[model samples]
Target: MNWKGHITLGIIMGLPFISAPEQIFLLVAGALYPDLDHDVKSEIVQRGLYISGGLILVSILAYLFRPEYFNVGFFIAAILSSLIYVIPYYAEHRGITHTFFSLGVMSIILGYLTFKLSIISPIMASLIALIMVTNNNLLGKSIAISVFAWVLYSMISTSFTTFQGLKFYIIPIAIGYLSHIVGDCITPMGCKALYPSNYTFRKKEGFFGVAIWALLVFYVVKLV
Candidate 1:
């Protein structure tokens, strides 16, 4: 899937947890984080440095100024989340970043954040996870434009209200991350989600992809 499709899948997967719509950005971050290990020439690495840099600076300021309330764990974990997911310079495209080990580490970090902090810190942390430069599934500015449109549409049209905020946030972070791997599974280049094993299988993209999208649309309708 392209970034637009991955992000749309992330939103639909995370739709159940969304209430105030700020969470959608966080979900988008999680959805795209799995592709964090890109070559130095990718768009995210070149253009997204500001995002990750700003996040690091913001996290530091929050930690220094609001030590009583700031979630230092989340900040640290967020940086670590990005660092841990990247493959070494010699690895393949969907290398360690797409592995189950990476997912488990991320889940643990996000899970700990959920246990310790308010939802806002986790949102920042999600953005940090998206700091890497990857080469696959990128779209043009159209991707960002489409993401904005979809979120706006959901916010305007959906009736699902807020619930347990922390639980909702954490659950969807996991789902968004997994949803990326699932989306990549259908591609000709399948993901190494299981890790330590060359045992991933590719799904036929034609009918399989259509069915997944159809199910997502149906689920979105149900959410409405």
Candidate 2:
């Protein structure tokens, strides 16, 4: 599946749990992140690196201004997150990044970064996530713009304290990442989510994909 499908699946899967602006952004980021292993020619890969690079710089600046707040742990976390984006440079397309191992690891890193950043600097985190969502080109722009506008409204009205805990952010990352793997699994090429095992998790696109979407939508409706 393509980025659009991956993001749509992520949103649908996460619909019931989304109660805040950052959750939506996290879901989008998680869905798009697996594609980071794509070639340098892929726009998602380049833009993801750009976002990670910018995040590293932002963390450094924040530390320089207030070591007491940003601290060494925060600085190290930023570097670790930035390194994730760089993995694509040396990784093969649909390689390690598509695996469950990467999914779990990325969820922890990104979840921590977003959680800490939102707690200490909501606006900065919001803006960075906004960029991460909106950089996926035209389709992404439309989805991100609408959701980001909602986030901005929430920020103005509620001071953007909507997300409060680590688990809240991590849930979206895990679900979104899993949804991306599922989406790719339905494609003819299948997915090597197990990795290191040459086994491919393949499925028929039409029936299986529709069933997955239908089940997810039904669950979302049940929540509503």
Candidate 3:
């Protein structure tokens, strides 16, 4: 899915835990995370990577040197800009990277790291990030079922851990990530719904071709 879709999904799904301002940050990061790997041949890849790296660096710097003036708006803009370019360059018409398994793996890894660092509530941030990555090509019912199953398993298995909020985190992350899948469905390069099941969907024309310019405009306006 695109950055707007990512942001919208994050805001919608993250409402349960974080405030509106934080939602914007989480959504933006989610939208840009997939573009960490970029190639020079692809303009989106080059630009997106630049933007994503810049945002991450800026956020880190702000957190370290000027916590009081950390501009969430700037962070959000960087994220949206990066995703706008990256989707077409790297992720569009992709495979598991746009699937539940990929999203789950990313969530687990990031969640663990966040937990270790005690950064921004690991369960909440991880869930938001996972949700942002999830695509919607998989049946909504199937996604829901999967999320529920994971939640149950987490609650049961991690009941004794301090990260007991894993269950609560799973639902939103699943939903948010699934939202990306759903958003991609509207574009030409559809997502692979039954990833491990070998089901694939493709759109003749994806959203990135024309939408990138618009996304840049919107992001600039938002920044202003």
Candidate 4:
């Protein structure tokens, strides 16, 4: 499935957790996260490089002039941006990144990073950066605005400092990540969710797949 389809499916998967705008944005970001492994020929790889370079430049400028704004967090974010570009540059399309293993690992890393760097959620920044680099279209803008609003709310609210740790994010991240895998499973190129086994899993063909997804969405919506 494409980004739009994956994003829609991801939202449905995360419906039960969607009480706030941040969760919605996170869901969207998670859906698109798997495609980070696109080949070098892909526009995503090129954009990743640009985003990485931009972050590095910003980090340097902040260090020189805005020292307070620059810290280990900025350095860590820069390193992450570089990895985001480098890893996808060498990764195979729909390879390890598309697997459930990658989903869990990424979620854990992001969860930890966000908590460890509380002054600035690298998880949100990195994912928002990915959103920007991924599309640069209407969807990206929508997600950005949502994230901006969430940040504004956080700053205005008392919960800013008392932010809960990894546990707060693990569920939504996993839901969104797994939703991406499920979205790909409906495609002709089925997803190998359980990697290292070389087994591909897909939904039934034709209307059956659509029906299953629709039914699931309906059930989830009802519960929500």
Candidate 5:
């Protein structure tokens, strides 16, 4: 999915579980996660690396100057989370970092980092990672009904009102990200859903493409 779709999906999906502030942070982070591995030519890679590096630097400064800036610590946690998911770039396409396994591993790592930084509870961080990862996988499909179902499932499963509860942020973020992928999947160029699973869906030409584009634009605006 395009950037807009990714962000929208993140926000819509994350809305029920997190405060507006937390949702914004997760949407930005999740939207940027996939591009962390982009090469020099890719805008996502360039922006991600710069943003990650900047966040790390800011975190260090915050830690040194004002320990009360505990929130800045989450930025550091985000950088570390990206690093864990982005390393060994070769494993990216091979589905190592893109699967449920990597999702669990990275969530644990992120949860620990967040706990150490005292930014959020370890459990919250873990749930957030899980939501983001699941959404990422769902976004790669082309079927609208399937995409809607995925979003519905995420909303139903992760919906929560308090942080002390199940923490619905992850599920919404996942649905948002997945919605983007589904949008992309219906494009003429298509998307590889079930990558490594040998399943692919092609887009129908004409109005379907136009409709998808419209929906994409709507979500993008919503997310941004």
Candidate 6:
């Protein structure tokens, strides 16, 4: 399925856990982000960059107007912008990043950035970044990811242990990302969700999309 279908499924699977605007944004963004390696031309990726840019603008506004959240605003923008750009560049379609290990690593990195970095903004930024991975038209994704990979080499290596004070808000990112990988199982070349397992769910590829959409509608009703 495309980003539209994937994003819908992701949001549906995620709505039960969301009550805040930040989570909502991140959840939808996460749904569209995993496809950065598959289809860089997808509209969701561009939309995500717009969203990220908007957040950065918001951060700047906060820096000038809402002094209380200024540091956090910029921090959130910076962290998210970095992550969104990095994932797609290093990862190929259905490559290592599509695996459970990569997902776990991404989640851990997100958790550390959220807590160890000071609580709220890092997670939000990570969510934003994930969405923006699709934004290859601008190539900001490439440059940003390269710089981030080099700069955060040491920190990323030690990130798994940094989740000291994480909360429930981050669950959406994990769930949405998982939803993306699973949804892609409806393709001829199945995703590398388990990496070394070398599995493909071609049998379910044709009609599974309908099932996902059904679930999405069901979840949307409940959320409403």
Largest lDDT belongs to which candidate?
2
The CA lDDT at 33 in model 2 is 79
Whichever of 2 and 3 has more TM-score, that candidate is 2
Query: Considering summed lDDT, which 10 consecutive residues are worst modelled in model 3?
Result: 156-165
- Report lDDT per candidate: 0.58, 0.67, 0.46, 0.63, 0.45, 0.55
Q: By TM-score, is 3 or 6 better?
A: 6
**Models sorted by lDDT, best on top:** 2, 4, 1, 6, 3, 5
In model 1, which regions exceed 4 Å deviation?
Answer: 40-91, 110-165, 204-224
As a whole number from 0 to 100, the lDDT of residue 104 in candidate 4 is 83
Q: Report the Cα lDDT for candidate 2.
A: 0.67
lDDT of 6 by residue, 1-224 (tens): 77667666666565555444345444554565566665544455455456657767777788899888778745664656556545665667777666667666665555444444445465455443443444543334433433343344434333211112454435656666767777777666777576777765454642564465456546543332
Q: TM-scores across all candidates?
A: 0.58, 0.70, 0.41, 0.64, 0.43, 0.53
Residue 64 miss distance in model 6 (angstroms): 30
lDDT of 2 by residue, 119-152 (tens): 7675467445535434436345635643854555
lDDT of 5 by residue, 1-224 (tens): 55556555555544543432333444334433443333422343334346667777777788789878847547756677557545524444323333333434444454355346334554455334434333344334322323454455465454334443323344333334444444455656554444446444446532353465456445543231
Residue-wise C-alpha lDDT for candidate 1, range 25-113, written one tens digit per residue: 55665677666565643455444444545666778888889777677665775565334333333346677756657666665555455
Best by TM-score: 2
Better of 4 and 6 by lDDT: 4
Residue 82 accuracy (lDDT) in model 6 = 51
Q: Per-residue lDDT of 53-172 in model 4, one digit per residue for the tens?
A: 888888899989999888876677666656655755676888787787878876665544444544476456545533533555745664655565456555534321111445455545
Whole-model alpha-carbon lDDT for candidate 1: 0.58
Q: Return the TM-score for candidate 4, rounded to 2 decimals.
A: 0.64
Alpha-carbon runs more than 4 Å astray in model 5: 40-88, 91-112, 120-160, 165-177, 193-195, 201-224
lDDT of 3 by residue, 90-132 (tens): 5544555566675565444433333332356654654444333
Q: Candidate 6, TM-score vs. the true structure?
A: 0.53
Better of 1 and 5 by lDDT: 1
